[model samples]
Target: MVTTWFKKFMGKRLFDRYYKFEKMLPVFAIGDRFCVTHAEPKTHYSEKDIVNALVNREIIFNLTWTDNGQAEIGSVVRYLYDFFPDNQEARMFGGHRPIPISQNYLSRAGGKYIQIHNPSWYNIVYVRDMKDFLIYRDIFSILPLAERLAKKEEI
Candidate 1:
Protein backbone atom coordinates (compact mmCIF):
# COMPACT_ATOMS: atom_id res chain seq x y z
CA MET A 1 0.00 0.00 0.00
CA VAL A 2 1.07 3.57 -0.55
CA THR A 3 0.86 4.34 3.14
CA THR A 4 3.03 1.34 3.97
CA TRP A 5 5.57 2.44 1.38
CA PHE A 6 5.46 5.99 2.69
CA LYS A 7 6.04 4.85 6.24
CA LYS A 8 8.98 2.71 5.15
CA PHE A 9 10.44 5.53 3.15
CA MET A 10 10.10 7.91 6.08
CA GLY A 11 11.59 5.29 8.46
CA LYS A 12 10.02 4.28 11.76
CA ARG A 13 11.24 7.09 13.97
CA LEU A 14 10.32 9.92 11.59
CA PHE A 15 6.97 8.38 10.72
CA ASP A 16 6.13 7.75 14.37
CA ARG A 17 6.97 11.34 15.28
CA TYR A 18 4.88 12.70 12.43
CA TYR A 19 2.04 10.36 13.33
CA LYS A 20 2.12 11.51 16.92
CA PHE A 21 1.95 15.15 15.80
CA GLU A 22 -0.90 14.45 13.41
CA LYS A 23 -2.86 12.60 16.08
CA MET A 24 -2.85 15.75 18.17
CA LEU A 25 -4.67 17.76 15.52
CA PRO A 26 -8.45 18.02 15.61
CA VAL A 27 -10.45 16.36 12.89
CA PHE A 28 -12.66 19.37 12.84
CA ALA A 29 -13.29 22.51 14.86
CA ILE A 30 -16.66 24.16 15.58
CA GLY A 31 -16.93 27.84 16.35
CA ASP A 32 -19.97 29.90 17.10
CA ARG A 33 -21.12 29.92 13.46
CA PHE A 34 -18.58 27.97 11.48
CA CYS A 35 -16.89 24.60 11.15
CA VAL A 36 -13.40 24.05 9.75
CA THR A 37 -11.86 20.89 8.37
CA HIS A 38 -9.06 19.88 6.02
CA ALA A 39 -11.54 18.19 3.70
CA GLU A 40 -15.25 17.48 3.50
CA PRO A 41 -16.88 14.39 4.93
CA LYS A 42 -18.07 11.84 2.37
CA THR A 43 -21.41 11.48 4.14
CA HIS A 44 -23.33 12.92 7.04
CA TYR A 45 -21.57 11.92 10.23
CA SER A 46 -23.40 11.56 13.52
CA GLU A 47 -22.05 13.17 16.69
CA LYS A 48 -21.03 9.71 17.89
CA ASP A 49 -19.23 9.01 14.62
CA ILE A 50 -17.27 12.24 14.93
CA VAL A 51 -16.33 11.46 18.52
CA ASN A 52 -15.29 7.93 17.62
CA ALA A 53 -13.27 9.09 14.62
CA LEU A 54 -11.32 11.44 16.86
CA VAL A 55 -9.93 8.47 18.78
CA ASN A 56 -9.96 5.73 16.14
CA ARG A 57 -6.65 5.72 14.26
CA GLU A 58 -7.93 4.01 11.12
CA ILE A 59 -10.96 6.29 10.87
CA ILE A 60 -8.78 9.35 11.37
CA PHE A 61 -6.36 8.14 8.69
CA ASN A 62 -9.16 7.62 6.17
CA LEU A 63 -10.76 10.93 7.00
CA THR A 64 -7.47 12.80 6.73
CA TRP A 65 -5.91 10.98 3.78
CA THR A 66 -8.21 9.21 1.33
CA ASP A 67 -11.63 10.85 1.12
CA ASN A 68 -11.10 13.83 -1.07
CA GLY A 69 -13.74 14.98 -3.59
CA GLN A 70 -15.96 12.09 -2.54
CA ALA A 71 -18.35 14.29 -0.60
CA GLU A 72 -20.98 16.23 -2.48
CA ILE A 73 -21.82 19.81 -1.64
CA GLY A 74 -25.29 18.80 -0.47
CA SER A 75 -23.87 16.19 1.90
CA VAL A 76 -21.45 18.72 3.36
CA VAL A 77 -24.24 21.23 3.90
CA ARG A 78 -26.31 18.59 5.63
CA TYR A 79 -23.38 17.65 7.87
CA LEU A 80 -22.92 21.27 8.81
CA TYR A 81 -26.58 21.70 9.57
CA ASP A 82 -26.76 18.46 11.54
CA PHE A 83 -23.79 19.34 13.72
CA PHE A 84 -24.43 23.06 14.15
CA PRO A 85 -28.19 23.38 14.12
CA ASP A 86 -28.22 26.42 16.35
CA ASN A 87 -26.36 28.52 13.79
CA GLN A 88 -28.44 28.84 10.63
CA GLU A 89 -25.60 30.85 9.12
CA ALA A 90 -23.13 28.08 9.86
CA ARG A 91 -20.50 27.66 7.14
CA MET A 92 -18.04 24.83 6.49
CA PHE A 93 -14.55 25.81 5.40
CA GLY A 94 -12.20 23.29 3.83
CA GLY A 95 -9.42 22.81 1.30
CA HIS A 96 -8.33 19.76 -0.72
CA ARG A 97 -9.30 20.75 -4.23
CA PRO A 98 -7.41 23.47 -5.97
CA ILE A 99 -9.68 26.03 -7.55
CA PRO A 100 -8.49 28.66 -10.02
CA ILE A 101 -6.30 31.46 -8.68
CA SER A 102 -8.77 33.93 -10.07
CA GLN A 103 -11.66 32.08 -8.49
CA ASN A 104 -9.75 31.84 -5.17
CA TYR A 105 -12.44 30.34 -2.98
CA LEU A 106 -15.41 28.36 -4.21
CA SER A 107 -18.74 28.92 -2.50
CA ARG A 108 -21.48 26.37 -2.85
CA ALA A 109 -24.96 25.50 -1.58
CA GLY A 110 -25.82 29.15 -1.06
CA GLY A 111 -22.53 30.02 0.66
CA LYS A 112 -22.66 27.27 3.25
CA TYR A 113 -19.41 25.73 2.01
CA ILE A 114 -16.26 27.66 1.19
CA GLN A 115 -13.26 25.84 -0.29
CA ILE A 116 -9.97 27.73 -0.22
CA HIS A 117 -6.91 25.71 -1.11
CA ASN A 118 -4.83 27.50 -3.69
CA PRO A 119 -1.54 28.83 -2.28
CA SER A 120 -0.86 30.63 -5.54
CA TRP A 121 -4.13 32.44 -5.14
CA TYR A 122 -2.91 33.98 -1.85
CA ASN A 123 -6.45 34.10 -0.55
CA ILE A 124 -7.18 34.97 3.05
CA VAL A 125 -10.61 34.92 4.63
CA TYR A 126 -11.21 36.73 7.90
CA VAL A 127 -14.11 35.70 10.07
CA ARG A 128 -15.48 38.63 12.04
CA ASP A 129 -18.39 38.17 14.39
CA MET A 130 -20.60 35.11 13.73
CA LYS A 131 -22.25 36.39 10.56
CA ASP A 132 -19.76 38.69 8.82
CA PHE A 133 -16.48 37.90 7.07
CA LEU A 134 -14.00 39.41 4.62
CA ILE A 135 -11.95 37.87 1.81
CA TYR A 136 -8.62 39.37 0.73
CA ARG A 137 -6.54 38.22 -2.24
CA ASP A 138 -3.13 39.57 -3.19
CA ILE A 139 -2.95 39.86 -6.97
CA PHE A 140 -0.02 42.28 -7.11
CA SER A 141 2.67 39.96 -5.69
CA ILE A 142 1.21 36.66 -6.93
CA LEU A 143 0.99 37.64 -10.59
CA PRO A 144 4.61 38.70 -10.91
CA LEU A 145 5.90 35.60 -9.14
CA ALA A 146 3.73 33.40 -11.33
CA GLU A 147 4.91 35.19 -14.47
CA ARG A 148 8.58 34.84 -13.56
CA LEU A 149 8.22 31.18 -12.67
CA ALA A 150 6.29 30.42 -15.83
CA LYS A 151 9.05 31.92 -18.00
CA LYS A 152 11.81 29.85 -16.38
CA GLU A 153 13.00 26.66 -18.10
CA GLU A 154 13.38 23.39 -16.19
CA ILE A 155 16.92 22.61 -15.05
Candidate 2:
Protein backbone atom coordinates (compact mmCIF):
# COMPACT_ATOMS: atom_id res chain seq x y z
CA MET A 1 0.00 0.00 0.00
CA VAL A 2 2.52 2.56 1.09
CA THR A 3 5.07 1.27 -1.38
CA THR A 4 2.62 1.56 -4.23
CA TRP A 5 1.85 5.14 -3.32
CA PHE A 6 5.51 6.01 -3.07
CA LYS A 7 6.17 4.42 -6.41
CA LYS A 8 3.39 6.43 -8.02
CA PHE A 9 4.62 9.65 -6.45
CA MET A 10 8.15 9.08 -7.66
CA GLY A 11 6.91 8.15 -11.07
CA LYS A 12 5.04 11.43 -11.35
CA ARG A 13 8.09 13.37 -10.26
CA LEU A 14 10.32 11.60 -12.77
CA PHE A 15 7.89 12.16 -15.58
CA ASP A 16 7.70 15.86 -14.81
CA ARG A 17 11.45 16.12 -14.63
CA TYR A 18 12.20 14.39 -17.94
CA TYR A 19 9.24 14.86 -20.22
CA LYS A 20 9.62 17.46 -22.95
CA PHE A 21 7.62 18.56 -25.97
CA GLU A 22 10.02 19.45 -28.70
CA LYS A 23 7.91 18.47 -31.69
CA MET A 24 4.88 16.15 -31.79
CA LEU A 25 6.58 13.68 -29.50
CA PRO A 26 7.93 13.68 -25.96
CA VAL A 27 11.66 13.51 -25.44
CA PHE A 28 13.60 12.49 -22.38
CA ALA A 29 17.29 13.05 -22.97
CA ILE A 30 18.38 10.30 -20.55
CA GLY A 31 21.71 11.87 -19.84
CA ASP A 32 24.53 13.91 -21.25
CA ARG A 33 26.40 10.63 -21.73
CA PHE A 34 24.96 7.13 -21.61
CA CYS A 35 25.57 3.53 -22.69
CA VAL A 36 23.35 0.90 -24.31
CA THR A 37 23.13 -2.91 -24.35
CA HIS A 38 20.69 -5.67 -25.18
CA ALA A 39 19.30 -8.31 -22.81
CA GLU A 40 18.76 -11.85 -24.09
CA PRO A 41 17.18 -13.57 -21.14
CA LYS A 42 15.95 -17.07 -21.94
CA THR A 43 13.48 -16.65 -19.09
CA HIS A 44 12.07 -13.72 -17.16
CA TYR A 45 15.30 -12.37 -15.79
CA SER A 46 15.96 -10.06 -12.85
CA GLU A 47 18.65 -7.66 -11.70
CA LYS A 48 21.08 -10.33 -10.66
CA ASP A 49 20.86 -12.09 -14.00
CA ILE A 50 21.54 -8.83 -15.80
CA VAL A 51 24.49 -7.98 -13.54
CA ASN A 52 26.08 -11.35 -14.02
CA ALA A 53 25.53 -11.42 -17.75
CA LEU A 54 26.46 -7.95 -19.04
CA VAL A 55 28.84 -6.29 -16.60
CA ASN A 56 32.38 -6.74 -17.88
CA ARG A 57 34.34 -6.85 -14.65
CA GLU A 58 37.51 -7.64 -16.60
CA ILE A 59 37.32 -4.26 -18.32
CA ILE A 60 38.20 -2.40 -15.11
CA PHE A 61 36.23 0.86 -14.93
CA ASN A 62 35.41 1.39 -18.54
CA LEU A 63 31.84 2.78 -18.63
CA THR A 64 31.52 3.94 -22.22
CA TRP A 65 32.39 1.26 -24.78
CA THR A 66 33.90 -2.19 -25.04
CA ASP A 67 35.04 -4.64 -27.68
CA ASN A 68 33.62 -7.95 -26.43
CA GLY A 69 35.56 -9.75 -29.21
CA GLN A 70 32.08 -10.88 -30.25
CA ALA A 71 29.50 -9.42 -32.56
CA GLU A 72 28.51 -6.80 -29.89
CA ILE A 73 30.61 -3.67 -29.83
CA GLY A 74 30.39 0.00 -28.94
CA SER A 75 28.02 1.83 -26.59
CA VAL A 76 28.24 -0.90 -23.98
CA VAL A 77 28.47 0.01 -20.32
CA ARG A 78 30.31 -1.67 -17.50
CA TYR A 79 26.94 -2.07 -15.80
CA LEU A 80 23.42 -2.84 -16.87
CA TYR A 81 21.75 0.19 -15.31
CA ASP A 82 24.16 2.40 -17.21
CA PHE A 83 22.10 1.61 -20.28
CA PHE A 84 19.05 3.79 -20.34
CA PRO A 85 15.58 2.29 -19.86
CA ASP A 86 13.74 1.05 -22.92
CA ASN A 87 10.25 2.15 -23.93
CA GLN A 88 8.73 -0.73 -21.95
CA GLU A 89 10.74 0.08 -18.86
CA ALA A 90 9.62 3.68 -19.15
CA ARG A 91 6.00 2.78 -19.74
CA MET A 92 5.98 0.51 -16.69
CA PHE A 93 7.08 3.31 -14.38
CA GLY A 94 5.66 3.32 -10.82
CA GLY A 95 5.68 -0.46 -10.74
CA HIS A 96 7.77 -2.37 -8.24
CA ARG A 97 9.61 -4.28 -10.94
CA PRO A 98 13.38 -4.22 -10.76
CA ILE A 99 13.75 -2.84 -14.26
CA PRO A 100 11.77 0.26 -13.26
CA ILE A 101 13.74 0.70 -10.07
CA SER A 102 16.95 -0.08 -11.88
CA GLN A 103 16.34 2.96 -14.03
CA ASN A 104 16.14 5.07 -10.88
CA TYR A 105 19.17 3.28 -9.49
CA LEU A 106 21.21 4.43 -12.47
CA SER A 107 20.47 8.05 -11.60
CA ARG A 108 21.46 7.60 -7.96
CA ALA A 109 24.69 5.92 -9.02
CA GLY A 110 26.06 9.11 -10.66
CA GLY A 111 24.63 8.37 -14.06
CA LYS A 112 23.90 11.68 -15.76
CA TYR A 113 20.36 10.67 -16.71
CA ILE A 114 18.99 8.09 -19.12
CA GLN A 115 18.55 7.53 -22.87
CA ILE A 116 15.94 5.56 -24.75
CA HIS A 117 18.05 4.73 -27.73
CA ASN A 118 21.56 4.40 -29.11
CA PRO A 119 22.04 3.68 -32.77
CA SER A 120 24.78 1.27 -31.82
CA TRP A 121 22.24 -0.91 -29.95
CA TYR A 122 18.94 -0.79 -31.67
CA ASN A 123 15.98 -1.57 -29.42
CA ILE A 124 14.60 -5.11 -29.42
CA VAL A 125 11.16 -5.64 -28.02
CA TYR A 126 10.33 -8.76 -26.07
CA VAL A 127 7.08 -10.49 -26.78
CA ARG A 128 4.43 -9.87 -24.13
CA ASP A 129 4.40 -13.42 -22.77
CA MET A 130 8.09 -14.12 -22.70
CA LYS A 131 7.81 -15.83 -19.34
CA ASP A 132 5.24 -18.19 -17.98
CA PHE A 133 5.26 -16.91 -14.44
CA LEU A 134 4.24 -13.47 -13.34
CA ILE A 135 7.04 -11.33 -12.03
CA TYR A 136 6.40 -10.29 -8.48
CA ARG A 137 6.08 -6.62 -7.68
CA ASP A 138 9.16 -5.52 -5.81
CA ILE A 139 11.57 -2.62 -5.79
CA PHE A 140 15.27 -3.28 -6.26
CA SER A 141 18.33 -1.16 -6.95
CA ILE A 142 21.55 -2.69 -8.19
CA LEU A 143 24.45 -0.25 -8.17
CA PRO A 144 26.87 -0.13 -11.04
CA LEU A 145 30.04 -2.19 -10.70
CA ALA A 146 32.25 0.89 -10.45
CA GLU A 147 30.06 2.49 -7.81
CA ARG A 148 29.74 -0.69 -5.76
CA LEU A 149 33.48 -1.28 -5.68
CA ALA A 150 34.09 2.35 -4.78
CA LYS A 151 31.73 2.07 -1.84
CA LYS A 152 33.53 -1.02 -0.62
CA GLU A 153 36.86 0.82 -0.72
CA GLU A 154 35.35 3.68 1.26
CA ILE A 155 34.34 1.29 4.00
Whose lDDT is greatest here? 1
Q: Relative to the unseen true structure, what is the C-alpha lDDT of residue 144 in candidate 1, on a scale of 0 to 100? A: 56
Worst 10 residues of 1 by lDDT: 134-143
Q: Which stretches of candidate 2 lie over 4 Å from their true place?
A: 1-64, 70-122, 132-155
lDDT measured at residue 8 in model 2 versus the true structure, 0 to 100: 81
Query: Candidate 1, residues 76-143: lDDT per residue as tens digits?
Result: 67777777777777787776667677777877556776777776765445567556554343212254
The models' CA-based lDDT, in order, is 0.66, 0.28
Off by over 4 Å in 1: 1-11, 55-69, 121-124, 136-155
- Residue 108's C-alpha lDDT in candidate 2? 20
Please give me the total number of clashing residue pairs in predicted model 2: 2
Residue 106 in model 2: shift from native, Å? 25
